[model samples]
Target: MMNDTTFETLPGRRRSDVVYKTLLDRLYSGQYARFSRLPTERELTEEFDVSRPVIRNALAKLRDNGLIRSVQGSGSIVLYEHARGDDASAGQVSIGDFQKCFEFRVLVEQEAAFLAAKHCDRAALDVIRQNIDEVDRYVQRGEYRIGKSFDFHRAIAMASENPFIVQALDRVQDFIGFKIYIARSMSLPNPVERLALINGEHSAILSLIERREGEEARALMRSHIERARDLFLGCLPLEVVSDREGR
Candidate 1:
C-alpha cells in the first residue's frame, strides 16, 4: 500500500468496478506481494468505503483473471503481476542476449527433434498431435494463439525423451512470443495468415518426426526456427538490434 493510498469517493453505481481496478492496480504494482493474502472482506469494505458485496465482486474479477486465489480460511492471494507496456522492463530485451540464447536453442532443439523422430512412441507422438490440433482449431477460427503454438513446441521437446531438452524449452519457450509481436506489427488484413503458416510449419515438422526421418526432421526443425527468427527480426529496427548485438 502506498503511504498516500488514495481512492476517489467510490459512488454506489460503479463501486464494484472501481474496487476491481483499484485492487488490480495494487496487485500489479506489488502493493500485494505474490502469494500474500489480501485484506479480508471486512477490512476491504472499511478501506474502500464500499459494501461487502462490492468488495466481494471486486475479488471475483481478480479470481476470474487468474491473478488471485481465494482460500476458504484465508483471503484473496496475489499470483501474477502481468506487466503492461508502461512497466519499465516490458519488451526491453537485450538483442545480443536474445541472439545468443536463440543460437543455443537452435542447436539444442535440432538434436531434440532428431532424437524425437527416432525414439518417440505412438503415445508420445499423440501428445504432440493433440497440441497441434489445438492450434489448428484455433487458427481455423482465425486466432493466432501464441501459447498454443508454444505448447506444441514444448510437446515435441518432451517427446525427445531428453529431460534437458524439456527443461531448456520450459525456460526459454516464451521467447517465441517475440515472433508473435513481430507478426502483429505487420498489421496484415488477414492476421490468420501468420498463424496458418506457423501451424503449417509445425504440421510438416510433425509429419517428418512421425515418419522417423531423423535427418529430415532435424533439418526442418532448424529451418523452422530460422524462418521464425527472420520473421521476428524483419519487423525490428536493424540499427537498434545491431547496436545491442555488438554490446
Candidate 2:
C-alpha cells in the first residue's frame, strides 16, 4: 500500500532498495507462498517500471537472504520458510565471534552516544524517547517488540549527528535484531530489565548531552554496551561454543 511519493523520497541510490523492501513485504505477507514461482524478470520489470538490473538486484537480495531461490530453467521460486531452515535451528554464534562483534559495536556506539549528547536536538531526543516508550508499552503487553527497539538505537545514532555513525549503526541494526530475537526465543528472563537498562542508559546519555558532558557520557555508554554484551552472551546455552560458524 505504499504510494509513489513514498518511493520517490528515498535517499541515496536507493530506488532499488525500495523495490527490494516492497518485494520482501509482499513475500512475508503471503502474496507469494512457498514454492510459488514468481513472475518472469521481464514481467517484474514492467510491473515496477524499473530496469532489468534493478529487478535483478532486488531478486538477488531476496536469494541472498534465503527468502527465495532461482532455478536454471524455471523462474525464481518462493522459499518463505527457508529462513528458519528445516530443523528450526538458527545460525550458530560463537562466543568469540559474538564478543568480537559486540566489541566493535561498543567502540562505535559509545562514540555515537557521546556525539549524540553533544549534537542532538530536542526533536531527536523526543524521537528516541517516544521509541523507548513504545518498547515499554509493547513489552508490558507481552508483545514481541524488535523493530521499535532497534529504532530507539537508530534514533540515538542519528542524534549523534555523524553521518558515518548513523550509517554504521543502520547497517548493523539487522544483526542487533537477530541477537535480540535469539535472546527472546531462548526465553531469557528479565527481558524488560535488559530493555529498561538500555533506556536508562540512553536517558543518562541525553542528560550528559544536555549538560555538555560528552566524555563522561561516552564512557558510560561504553560500559553500558559492554555489560549488555556480557548479559546477552550469558543468556545463550554453553553449547554455543561448539556451534560456531553455525554448523
Candidate 3:
C-alpha cells in the first residue's frame, strides 16, 4: 500500500521512470506473485492518474527488464517468484555463472566504491541512504526486496561519477538480479537474518564512503561480495554443488 504521492513528487524524475521504479519495487518485494496478473493498463492509468501511453511505457519497460511477461489476454504476469529448491529453476544460473558475475562485481564495484568514497555528493548519498532504508523497511515486514539492493549498488556507481561503470552494471543487471534471488533464497535459514547481514554490509560500505575512506571502502566491498558469493555457493543444492566440483 504505497501512497500515490510518493512517486508523484519525485523531483527531476519522469512519470514513466517513477512508475517503473515503483512497480519494480513492488515486484521485488513479492507484492505481485509469480504468474499473478497485474492491474490492467487502464487500471494503472486511473490509479496513477497519468495518460494511457505513460502506463504502457512503464509496462513496456518492465517487460524489457524481464520482470514481467505480457500475455495476449492475461495482461502482465510477474516473473520474480521465490526460488524453490531446484537449482535449474533458481534463476537458471550455473555455479560458474554465479562466480563470474560475482567476480565481475568485485572488479568493477570495488573501484566504484573507492571512487564513490572520493566523489559522492550529498544528493547521491541521500539516494543510497534511501535505498538502504527501503530495504530495512521491507526486511522488517518479512519481505526480500531485491530491487532495493540493486538500486543501492547502482546509486553508488552513479556516485562514482563513471557512466561506463554504471553501464557495465546495468548490462548485467538481469543476471545479477537472478543471482541475488538465489542467494537470498538459499544462503541462510532465516530470511530476516540473511537480509540483515546484507543490509549491514551495505550500511558499513556507505559509512566508509561517507567518511571518504577509499581504500577501506574498496576492501570492504570486496569482502562483502566475496562473503555473499561463498555463502550462496555453499548453500546451493547438492546436485549443483557437485556439478561445480566436478568441473
Model 1: weakest 10-residue lDDT segment is: 179-188
* lDDT value, candidate 2, whole model: 0.66
lDDT of 1 by residue, 76-173 (tens): 87765434465443434555555666677788889999999988999999998888888788777654445457677778888899999999876673
The Cα RMSD in angstroms, rounded to one decimal, for candidate 1 relative to the true structure is: 8.9
| Number of backbone-clashing residue pairs for each candidate, in the order shown | 0, 1, 0
Over 4 Å off in model 2, which ranges? 1-90, 139-147, 176-186, 238-247
**Tens-digit lDDT track for model 2 on 196-239?**
65666767766776677889978987887777677777776564
Between candidates 1 and 2, the one scoring higher on TM-score is 1
| Ranking of predictions according to TM-score | 3, 1, 2
- Listed in order, each prediction's TM-score against the native is 0.60, 0.57, 0.62
Model 2 has a clash total of 1
- Runs of candidate 1 with Cα error greater than 4 angstroms are 1-91, 174-190, 237-247
Ranking by lDDT: 3, 1, 2
Model 3 ranges with Cα > 4 A deviation: 1-66, 69-74, 78-91, 176-188, 238-247
